[model samples]
Target: MDKFTTLTGVAAPMPLVNIDTDMIIPKQFLKTIKRSGLGKNLFDELRYEADGTEKPEFVLNQPAYRNAEIIIAGDNFGCGSSREHAPWALLDFGVRCVISTSFADIFYNNCFKNGILPIALPQDVVDTLMEDAGRGSNARLTIDLEGMKVVTSDGTEFPFELDPFRRHCLLNGLDDIGLTMEKADSIRGFEEQMATARPWI
Candidate 1:
């Protein structure tokens, strides 16, 4: 996981609602536990045609949004299965942040754990951001996690709410394993004591 203090980059507009986990990476690509290779398959069905050619109509296929670091999507984003691969695919594709009117609970939680910021804003606010993201390569949006603000290219700012603990974790690049490592000394001490007390085992 990487620290996500702040980010400024192109935001691709994906107004489709109910973007499920399977749609994100597709079940065929979920065989591997590794997270790195999924970027190429992110939204595989939508991004490619049956012949495996890039779909020109897809937002991510467009030249301007090919390298987008953020996604502004419609309501009920990430709404299906609880597979963690969805966030992995998004992060691997360089999407550090996602702004939507709403999101599925499991997917939203997974995003934070994977170092992706899933922001849930009001519908009107999301609509504004979606429009802003329509500006092709100029759709640069800035997300300041410490400030809890999303700033548009035109300077409009929208404040969003997030759990304090999640914010802390992301700011310091602490995933579940990283959180456990924070108490490394204590864990090591406990193991040593156990070994000493149970030499026979």
Candidate 2:
């Protein structure tokens, strides 16, 4: 997991609603437990054709958005299925933050665990970011997690709400495993005590 204090980068505009997990990485690519290789297949169906050719129309495939680090998306983003691979694909593809009017509950939670920031903002605010993203790669957006605000290239700033605990986790690059590791000494002590007290077992 990577610490996400602040990010300023290209933002791709994806206005499609109900973008399910399968659409993100597709079902075929879900066989692997490893998270690294999925970036090439992120939005596989939308990015590539039946013959494995690139689709020019998709936002990610476009030249300007190819390296986008942020995504300004439509309402109901990340709907359907609870596969964790969805966020893995997004992260691998260099999307550190996603701004949307709404998101599916499971996916939203998953984003925080995977080091991806899923921001829920009002529809009007999302619309503004989407339009800024529409300006292409040159119009980079700035997201300051510590400040809890998203700023457009033109200097407009919008505040967003986030759970304090989740914010702490991301700032420290603490995933579930990372959180557990933070209490390594306590865990070791507990195991040692258990072994001595239950000698037979």
Candidate 3:
């Protein structure tokens, strides 16, 4: 996981709602446990035709959105299965943040764990951001994680809420494993004491 202090980059507008985990990375691509290389398959069905060629009509295939780092999507984003691979694919695709009117609980949490910021704002706020993202190359949005705010290219700013602990973890690049490693000394001490107390085992 990478630290997500601040990010300023292109934002792609995805107005479709109910973008499930499978859509983020189709079921066929879920066979592997590795997180890398899934980006190529992100939105596989929508990004490619049956022949496996890039779909020119897809938002991601457009030249301006090819490198989009932020996504402004419609309501009910990330709804459906609880596969953690969704966030992995998005992160691998260089999407550091996703702004939507709402998101499925499991997917929202997964995004935080994977170093991707899933922001749930009011519908009006999301609509504004979505419009801002329609500007193609000029859709530069700034995500200030520490500041808990998103700034549009035109200088409009909107504050968002986040759990303090999740905020802390992202700022320090701490995932579940990283959180455990933070108490390495304590864990080692506990193990040593257990061994000494139960010598037979």
Q: Name the best candidate (by TM-score).
A: 3
Cα RMSD, each candidate: 1.1, 1.0, 0.9
The models' CA-based lDDT, in order, is: 0.93, 0.93, 0.93
lDDT of 3 by residue, 77-112 (tens): 898999999999999999999999899999999998
lDDT of 2 by residue, 90-164 (tens): 999998999998899999999999999999999989988999999998899999999999999999999999999
Model 3 TM-score relative to the real fold: 0.97
Worst 10 residues of 1 by lDDT: 130-139
Candidates arranged by TM-score, highest first:
3, 2, 1
lDDT of 2 at 31: 94
- Models 1 onward score TM values of 0.96, 0.97, 0.97
| Backbone clashes in model 3 | 0
Off by over 4 Å in 1: none
In model 2, the clashing pairs are none
Please write out the lDDT profile of model 1 over residues 1-201, one tens digit for every residue: 799999999999999988888898899998999989899999999999999999999999999999999999988989889999999999889899999988999999999899999999999999999999998897699999999999999999999999999999999999999999999999999999999999888
